[model samples]
Target chain A: MNTHLVEPEIVMAYRDGQLAAGEAAGVRAHLETCAECQEIAASLDDVSAQMRAWTVEEPSPQLAWRVAGRAGKPKGKFWWWHWPTAALVTAVLVVAVLPWKRPPAPTVQTGWLPVGSVRTSESNLPLPPAEPRRHDSVAEIGPQAQARTGQLGGVIGGIVSATPMAAPPTSVQRRTQAQFAMEARRGAAIPVPTAPMIARDATLNLTVKDFASVRDVVERIVRVHRGFAQNLALTYQAGRNNLTATLRIPDPELDRTLADLRYLGKVDQEAQNGEDLQAQHVDLAARIANSRVAEARLKELLANRTGKLSDVVEAENELSRVREDIERMQAQISSMENRVEFATVNLRISDTPPVPAPSSVWRGLSEAGRNGLTILGEGLMGVATWLLEYLPTLIVIVLVFFFPVRWLWRKLQARPAFRLPN
Target chain B: MDLTGSDESLMLEVKQGSEPAFIALFERYARPIHGYFRRRMGDPQRAEDLAQETFLALLKGARRYERRALFRTYLYAIAMNLLSAERRRAAKDRGSTTDEPATSADPDAVLWVRRAVEQLDDQQREVLLLREYEQLSYEEIAGLLNVPVNTVRSRLFRARMAMKELLVTR
Candidate 1:
């Protein structure tokens, strides 16, 4: 036997039967002769013995019966229920949030004229009060003229009374006696030629290849059709040009002029309207004739002087009112005739360079890929910025609530269901 | 009464819907399974519950059983998983560690031994207990714990040495 003792680990390993056959034999030979090694081995065994001495209590008899009863029976299916429950919860959340996600309705404003005010034409009506009208030259006409046009027309031909007749006029009785004397001098005058009036207007939206060429072409078309451009505006911006022009063409040549303009570009939109003003013109002509008759009668009454001073003053006032009415009717009649002769055309022209075709599929795909990567990078950067912006709030929330939540969790854990009964 | 067969054969019989074979396996392993849980847990009732849970797990998994390893290895793996789950539950519920001082029948020698074993680190304690009580070899302990045999040997040796020192000093 060797004189020196083996290491304690070797001794423990030998006792544990962990050593190989030859090493176990060597340890065994040393242990037979060496009391110290034997004692160390005995101590290791003694530790195991002491640990093994702790008694293991038998499980209650009910456990075996319960487990046996469960045998040959299929286990309850738990995972099968989880999927449907998750889907139901998701559906409930979506339903609860749906209404809050909807956008709000826009507000609308409608402007109406005050009652008792009279308007002669549709153009005289005011726009909605919420939005101020844009100052376009074609729409503006003239501010002063527009204001005057909005007022009610004066009484005509005694058909519409300006004011209630208070009493029988002394001027009218004197005018009748004087008119009988004047009738012997001259007969009544006849009216001039009248025609059916129709106002023609059109709106066009055009996309043109060359803006400058289109303007020249439009001017040539108007000249050929014996028309004049009312308002011509050209705006240049960022490689694109926008043209807005209002032109007045001869009514007889309107169709030919519009066709020639359409040939200059692609017409994206067009609208035409013709309004008949024959009844309005006829009414005005009749009113003017009646007013002329009244004026002539009043002038005869003033010239005769068969009445008192009050009658003479009344007659002069009547004559002036009649003259003003006739003048207004005459002006309206002239304007109506001009509108019937000319057709108003509103044109909006946009000139933009055509988009270049893609060079090849590979180049197109590569461009698309580059754009996608740029968008992705921007999105990631936005997310990072948002997180950094809210980081302070997150930290404060964690600091304020972490310890209290942990303490409450601990307190709850200390309660009955968590801890075993003492 | 004729129950002399390998654990795999008995498990195979249980898989085939043989209730008698299942009962035989239960009778054979009930004590060791109960003792395993009893040594690890402080409360006897909880140990009993864990032992029953282990058997229940075995029964549930029997339909899909394959003869890959020894039935004892399969049984211990299930027991280990259940033990981990129970420890987690106890920790979450009680806010204390699972290896509390156990109430033994003999409080003098057994209590001292239990206290000394509990004082060791979790890995060393498990290795030592599996070796001493379960009588598993180093290779078996390595297989059960998913470590090398050398690690199991070293851990067991160190655990024994520490236990001896603790017992002697006290």
Candidate 2:
């Protein structure tokens, strides 16, 4: 027997029954005589037989219960199982019948302008001119801001100042606006270098019976606590009024201020914020000192300027720069001092009772009935509106369907009755 | 015995909602089906669960059954789906840095056979299992798996060749 005639793969193919009838016969003929192929076949059979013997360990008996229970639960049909065709049709209808037109412009009593008109710079109206006023240190900026800024700044500052400020005592926010105003007026008064006032601030919402009563209580607390209002705003509406005052209280008096505030109403939300500005204040003081020295040196240089024209120009320019730096440093010192002197307490006092809304649902219904009747009586108005909206499309559709309808009518009229089959 | 008639009539009765016929079908196929799962999973518990799941699947899928293939083939196909799902779920739940290699507690010969079968890519393994274990004809396996008969032959050939090489090495 030629060993070349019986390959291992051919033996396996025969074992697996994958070979063609003729090839299988050839392998079988060789297998009857060839010891090598026979051995390979026997090994293959042994491997497969062993594989057949490798059985999985029986699962825990409890699995049967779990599986049976799971299988017993009624199988749910998928959502897409019901009325699939109808759902498909509905989707198509929604895509077709639903209006995809862009929204019409809102009726503008101002003017019926094109949608993108506001986008053009050409149509942009100039803002109203600002009114001029006197330049008094405080009174000047006041009259100009009296209505808007006064309502916001003074009252807002009062509320903020009432809240404890986190900055050290030396910060300018520690100073009440009144004190800052006074200091600015005293222009040359040497600022007393005091330890920075550090005030911790807390935000709390309180419901109060009366805004005025709360305001008074807050003020009394501030005075007793050695704090002052930085900004105060009192808005009086028809039913309820709101008084938001930012105040500054001494850190020692913060607890008492908070206690007084708690008595005013139910505290809704309260959060305290603390800031440490000791390092920042020190840094600012150093910068101011450096700027002052620089300013002094520049001033001396300006006084003794006797050089070439270009040199003198350069020296004056240097002085101008130094003056700017000094002014900036002074501003920074004032701000830091304010923060240190004043601890900001922002108090928001809103009326406990909600105001009754005007023309609620019932009123709106009555109004709608009247308006709707008015609109219905003017039936021609709706017709006009619809006509204006679709006239172009209607004309195009008419032209498109006219010839088709005419041809169909002619064909139908020309058709003869069917003769009976003979 | 008329095997096709008995199986078909039994399936038809089961389809008619006969709980008895279902019980009979279960009794007839439970061990073979369990053995099939056991061979594939190498875990007795998982095999038993899978066997039960295959029966449940057959029961549930009865309403949609058109007798398109031999009920056994259809049943094994459902078992295959359940097995694939279980394997996927197991892999997902493992969540290990390295994947566990597929091996059985069997002797080297059996492990060699399984590894060799696994080494033949997915299509080939499927064809081999259907041919060898399920004893499905090439044409029947092709129709059930939605592949051409010729493709089934080639895959089976490749599977056999790979298995022979594995067995030779062993």
Best by TM-score: 1
Best by DockQ: 1
What does candidate 1's lDDT look like per residue over A1-422, in tens digits?
55565877788889988889999999999889888888889999899888878877666767765564444232333222233343445545554554532222222212322212211221222211121222222232344423322332231101111222222111111123234234423533323335556788999887776565566556644643456788899997776788899998767667766665664466789999998888887788788778888888999999999999999999999988997887677667666766767789998878756567679999899989999999999999989966675556555545555566556545533332111111
**Deviation (Å) of A142 in candidate 1:** 93
Q: What DockQ does candidate 1 score?
A: 0.25
Docking class of 2: incorrect
Model 2 lDDT vs. the true structure? Answer: 0.59
**lDDT (tens digit, per residue) of candidate 2 on A307-331:** 7778878877886786576566567
Find the 10 residues in a row with the least total lDDT in model 1 chain A.
Answer: A155-164
- C-alpha RMSD of each candidate structure in angstroms: 22.8, 28.0
TM-scores for candidates 1 onward, in order: 0.40, 0.34
Q: Which TM-score value belongs to model 2? A: 0.34
